[model samples]
Target: MTVLHQLRRALLKPPSFTQAYGGTRTLTSPYHTENNSTAFIKPDDQNNRKTQGKWLTLPPFNTTINGASLGKNIAGIRQSTGEGNESTTTAIKWVMRCCPQLPRSLVQKLFRLRQVRRKPLESSNSVGDVHASECQVKRVSAKDSMRFGDTVYLPITVEASPTEKTECLCTEEELKFLHDLELYKDSAIIVINKPTGMPVQGGIGIKRSLDELAGTYMRYELSEAPRLVHRLDRDSSGILVLGRTQYSATVLHSIFREKTIGASNIDLKSEKRFLQRKYWALVIGSPRRPQGLISVPLGKVVMDDGRSERITVVENVSTTASQHAITEYRVLDSSFHGLTWLELSPLTGRKHQLRVHCAEVLGTPIVGDYKYGWQAHKKWNRIQIASSNLEHKIEVCNKSSLPFGLNLESGSIADKQPNLHLHCKKMVLPDVSSAIKQACISSSDYDFADIKSLKFDAPLPPHMQRSWDILSS
Candidate 1:
């Protein structure tokens, strides 16, 4: 029988194997063929199929109300839909809507309740933000519980979270790699070497990233768990930042938005439109020179008759253009030794900015970079660079020094070619709160160093890590 047929037969029988990696399905889970009962299959089983749909294409979101960039702070907001069933805050009911404009006061109030998380984004799901559309206000002054008139559709963002999650793929040995580089931090602005081949968020398998592994060392290391201020590609590795508090999230965001140029991360709060950024990459072939810049404006292109993601671009600005972007790059090193090593400084943060700039603009894409680059650039999907992670593996955990089952045997080697070598490099800013609070702003005042490292090697998947060792040697 065909594998599909055998699988289908098994699916029709009693206990099923098709459903295991498929994970559990929900009331909202779509049928294999969308609204068709004849084509029912779990996600994991669907993976083996021809993938009639797109690979890693983000699922459609209930985005009806993605609250992008707005902190929940408003006191009371009343959307102007004027419909009786409009969204409200107090209603337990939820209805899907797309990017609703919420009242300012209601937005502010959510920030107070801690109902929303400001940073260390829920990158698993591609869905961005959600705000309720309509909700009924209640006054339960003397009672423990309150009554409601009708279901108010308040703006709500629902991220994809697993009902049962697995331990992060970041293993004990991997943690050591990061620990050697100053990976752990109690204060904000923590750094670590991100491993490649894992999505930043939302999945069924044992994958890990800064967001997934943040909790592993969070409590023991800092007063607060750090949150990522930005995103890195699943395959790319390099420097990344985390925020410990909302205030830090705010300051760091401002710094990124304004692209502040000063060294003190807190000092650039007042600077307007100034950003300094640098990154490193190991590409497929030797570059023209060790250094140069690639400039282009990126534009979103649609594809598959609108079935899935299109090739994202960095198109130059047109005289009558609606969008424009520019990226600068310089090759730091190159070799017939196999590939090109480069340093990139992005002047802008457009979608797929760096990847597209590398593949299309400069013609030297980061090795293992998925979603962009040349059709044949299929090395591994892990970027040669590590995330802002800058620490080396610490020998903190010892198998011979451990108890029974936990004692482990290990083997490893370094990459012949560098992994995605991107690093946040450095950023500076000013302490804008007050002089009294400024004393805490010392650069050396960081807390957790578990993620910190002295060396930059990450534990790769067996095959890739092996390849790296062979190449580097």
Candidate 2:
């Protein structure tokens, strides 16, 4: 054959050739016709065919291959695949089109190398440890700096030394008082009528609290002392529930967190149990409407002196620093003395929500509230003083602070006015059976078959009763 015709025939042949009768195959170079075993496909021709899917020739079996060049070729293929320019199907199709002698199964196996090498990098460390470290960083940075007037303040944390566990002490009279305070009790829970001037939980300089007394009171019936499921303000008397068992406590906590009682009737009638609490309060003046719902956000503002904090209606709703609080109030009775008796049902359990709502939103603070109440004793002097020369007065008082303004001390206002006139009158607990069933579904360890649903009503405390008697009379 002519040299030109042989060259053209080599160009027309496929890149990878197989013997037409399938034994051993020989690759002939386009430049040589001597049947040399050292002949190879030119680098330029191989690269151009790789890119353009054109036909070229493969090297003889004994031909020496450059390890570095082979690595570069594999890397180029991986890069193209990574960039989404080449997929497994496209690679297989290209391999078949350019090298018809290559098997489809072998091409599939070669494509799997990309996936094997591209596995996601995983760490040996636990995710919880990383999350806990992040939380520590956030906690360190969350120390709030509060400003009031000219002072910048930060809260101080006091660490107390561990004290010996001592049995609570109670006098016979006190024991009788505690027994009388029991509004309701069952296998799962105990409802107590907390009294005014009694702290629910001990605090700085406080030696005795209702919780201590409760421990002594229930020590006879329970091997493990009953645990208070929730807390009421120190001076705000009302119904309190104590869980007698761990399962009951967990269930009660979930109910309170979900605000089950305040949910709709459909929710109450569902499989889950619900609870409802009601309180009565006497505030100075009446709301413009006889009955209404107050929806406001509340946030605590530390005083400029850093000695105390006060709950107030958050004026700005855009910030996440404030919590949403809602309360429904009805004017039960209005007295000639400019006081109105109100029945309040809080929809959300925010600290001092009712107090802030009544004082700020309704323009009528509770009668004995010293912090958020009307400053009845502020003396206004009309002497025309220069605004620049007048110094702003700093007023400070120490009173028990409660969430949302519960039973805060009246301070100087207590001398003239009575104690906090708010009282938790009644509480409705969810059906014990339904709650236990739900708890069982959530946890296999729970079995509340012995517990029964309960409702309790607490008579108005002496201070509130006196005010009602005088105002109604």
Candidate 3:
């Protein structure tokens, strides 16, 4: 026989130990031809076509591995298939795309712990065949390439099973409370006037939050729950926005982030890509200028307790940690009793920016803002008490300026704690519902009538209105 014929015959010879084993064994070997293409062949007893493999070009080891036909492996786990082309995405990128809410740092930590795994590329079996047991437990690196059919296994910590968690985090009453607060709702977004003293998200010692309640009961007919697009402070009552869909949430988040970072470049009068938030604050004193901008840099300072932190105006303009804050203020009404109603428009979003600017920069701290305006409140109380005449004594004593039936007595009692007077009264931003619908449906046929900016107005909370009435009277 020729050398080539002899080599092929020898390669097809079965191993002597195969007879001792119960099941049939299959082996694939690559044969190179003159054209530099490689083909694989297997030895079989029944069919000649089954013995001859198809000619194919193998990709590099760094590329994604080929996937097997849809079949359960030895562990009864269904194997996924890959596309014909190679995938350029990394393992971590693929995981993040599958789970958008997961933090990147946590994914890196999982990779470091070797919790990310995948099925072996070579273990892919044909239709109705079972892969080796080891194939189901193979771990992969985060830097590894992800193929279309590759099954990337993340740890249980990454993807929690619904069966594992039996208890519901939100109660029925809380869900109803959230539903009652909804100001507007559509397919893309849900707007609510968040109540004062209620937290938007949970933290340490927080048993309940608005986000948990909304996600539990606000799903309606959608498969996924609503997600918060922006946050409102725990003590501030305002128009809070939540995205009903993932795409809308992502788009709204990007738009809000852009508005906060570059407020000067955004045109407030523009019909698109603009966010206008107007606040009504009951301040202790009136601004010297009727209406102007308060440009100041603010920074956070942790208290000596190491836990409590507060936002304050940074005296040094060169400080890198400080954030630039701009707010437009117009004096609405002033009272002879040392009170002023001010309309505030914050150009940039910052933590407690309005409270800090009003107290430190403009010297007119918001009423009931004890963190920044405690001293001003005490002075106003003393002045009002000293100048009290017998004629107006009964009126002042019967109707206190403080809300929630509380007086100016300072203590740990609930009656002494006052509510914040800074309220988010109005907002104007791009119509997220229309934008999402237009992107999903036919763009050419979409109507532009409802695409105009969405306008929302929230009335002041009872406490704020009472403070306004006291000031006006």
Give the better candidate number (1 or 3) by TM-score. 3
What is candidate 3's TM-score against the reference? 0.63
Write model 2 residue lDDT over 171-221, tens digit each, in one string. Answer: 675567668778776665778888787888878977877777676567443
Off by over 4 Å in 3: 1-173, 267-273, 382-417, 440-451
Q: Output the lDDT of residue 92, model 1.
A: 15
Top candidate when judged by lDDT against the true structure: 3
User: Model 2: residues >4 Å from true position, as ranges?
Assistant: 1-164, 260-273, 374-415, 437-453
lDDT of 2: 0.51
lDDT at 467, model 2: 59
Candidate 3 clash figure, as a count: 2
lDDT of 3 by residue, 1-473 (tens): 25335433433443222121113223222211121111222245546333222111122123321111100111112233333223366777665544434556666766776656564455545311333423353567899876545545443333221221122554454556567788988766889988777788978987667777676677765534578977777777889998775545665676676667677665555545457788998888788888888888899899999989999988886754898988888998888867788889888888899999899988999877899999987776532322233233223333343332223222111124457788899998777666544533432323433456788999887667655554554
Per-candidate TM-score against the hidden true structure: 0.45, 0.54, 0.63
Clashes of each: 110, 7, 2
Full-model lDDT for every candidate:
0.38, 0.51, 0.60
| Tens digits of lDDT, candidate 1, 1-473 | 25334433433333221231133222222212211111112246545444221111112222111111111111011222222211122211111111112222333333333222111112222121112211112211111221221111111222111222354554576566546545434343455545444455546664445565664554233323355667776655555556554335544564455442222232323433233446656566655655555545556666768865634453344532323445556665554346665667676555567777777766666665645644635543433434233123312345555321221222221333333433344432222222113312322222211112222223333323333434443
